[model samples]
Target: MALWTLFGLRQGSATTRWPAPGGDDGQADVLGMPRYHPERCGDGCSACADACPTGAIVADAAGGLEVDYSRCIACQLCVEACPDGAMTASGDWAFGVRRREDLRWAESGDPPASPAPTAGYRRSLHIRHVDAGSCNGCESELQALNNPIYNLHRLGIFFTPSPRFADLLLVTGPVTNAMIEPLKAAYEAMPEPRWVMATGTCAVSGALTGGGYAAQQGLGDILPVDVWLPGCPPNPAAIIEALLMFLDRMPQRVRGGQYGE
Candidate 1:
């Protein structure tokens, strides 16, 4: 027998049974987007907002800070800068949502309910990914989906080369001016009832490079997005969670910039 075959037999299956109850999703001790505790905010403290490189947190009209999760790169600068416990690091990585507004932090009122999953994509999903101008961080995580540890195909989700056959358009990077036409072309090629997913913070809000001379902001102006997943580069498991949330196989965990429900 081949050496690889022998190793495989010895280790059994390396793939995780995640997205199912009790299965490991492989992210342990990983820090995700920062958690904002408005109650713990110190009087007139602007440390967190000032430290945020991507302008994810900014001064609101009330002199308080407003957090836009879409622009957050999860660098933990705000958490480190906060004298109070208002901004703290967290492990809540699943930040996928259908609406862009839900990614902003809100102090009161009920969280928006998750939109019903599209009936047609419940069983399987085919994705077409575009790299507009990424640093390849998101692409690295995406490649891991096919590794033995992830085995993404087991879940019936796949990455297809052709946009015409894809159900979702997964985009990475802060789209550059050069890619605008091509990106639109890809979206146009997809059949009707297709969905779009902004796969990283760069794609969701242009990250630290928004409004540059060469790069446009995120996909907000370019195309309609059905799922917005923000991370500097979201891990493989988080990406999986986002897909499931889109298909309604799992409940959305983040709303109003808070993790959970």
Candidate 2:
């Protein structure tokens, strides 16, 4: 608690003044999305598709490329695989969903409602996270929320160690066979009006480990997932966007969207 206070004090003292309406912050270089240049591509090559571990890139018969944003792990393997600079990483990071379905690439064009409620009406969520035999990437991002940069506590989101006292269960990793029963027990232990968020590619789709001996399909096989954060290890910003979905502060993805509409 003292550490939090000291950090809070430091943040308060280090605050910067707002820039004028048209003024440049000089940090503009840090912003903007990545653009892909298809013209630089060499024809009759499928190296990018072959190199993608998740198979997010596909070459159509017409000799064009299709990148599935939802399936793309953002691992940058394709970016490196593109010898012609056809695949570039973008920084247009404003990925948010009001509906659950908007979280997927195949579900674009649907109208989604903002998932998060307006200010003063947000609910205080107590999240209980379970490892379930993960590689700890999810936990690392979860911990980032508490850091001064994210400061999830400012939005009334708290991480509690005990499932019994939690209002939401934030689960990581694929539900391994051995941990299935324990995961169920934890979900059952939570009180009424509870929510569960599956926070990784392993938890959402099982990904590479979906067919493993220890893996038990996915989290949906056990408890119903309210929100799905789709990444091998989701960025902290993605996790925050998902959390905001549960709070009803962001728009909900519409039908046929990546996340639930």
TM-score of each: 0.96, 0.71
What tens-digit string does per-residue lDDT give for candidate 1 at 106-212?
A: 87524758665485555578999999999999999999999998899999999999999998999998899999999999999999889999999999999988789
lDDT of the structure predicted as candidate 1: 0.89
> What C-alpha lDDT, on a 0 to 100 scale, does residue 185 get in candidate 2?
92
Kindly list the per-residue Cα lDDT of model 2 for residues 1-261, writing each as its tens digit. 699898878778332221223532233333222234556768877778788775557787888766544344567777778888777765433333333345433414465444333335456888899887678887887887776555667667798989999988888888888888899999999987777887776776676676578796457778877776667677666676667756765544323322232
Candidate 2 at residue 218, lDDT?
58
Score residue 59 of candidate 2 by CA lDDT.
Answer: 81
Top TM-score: which candidate number?
Answer: 1
RMSD per candidate (Å) reads 1.3, 5.7
Q: List runs of model 2 lying over 4 Å from the truth.
A: 1-45, 58-70, 83-86, 92-101, 111-121, 252-261
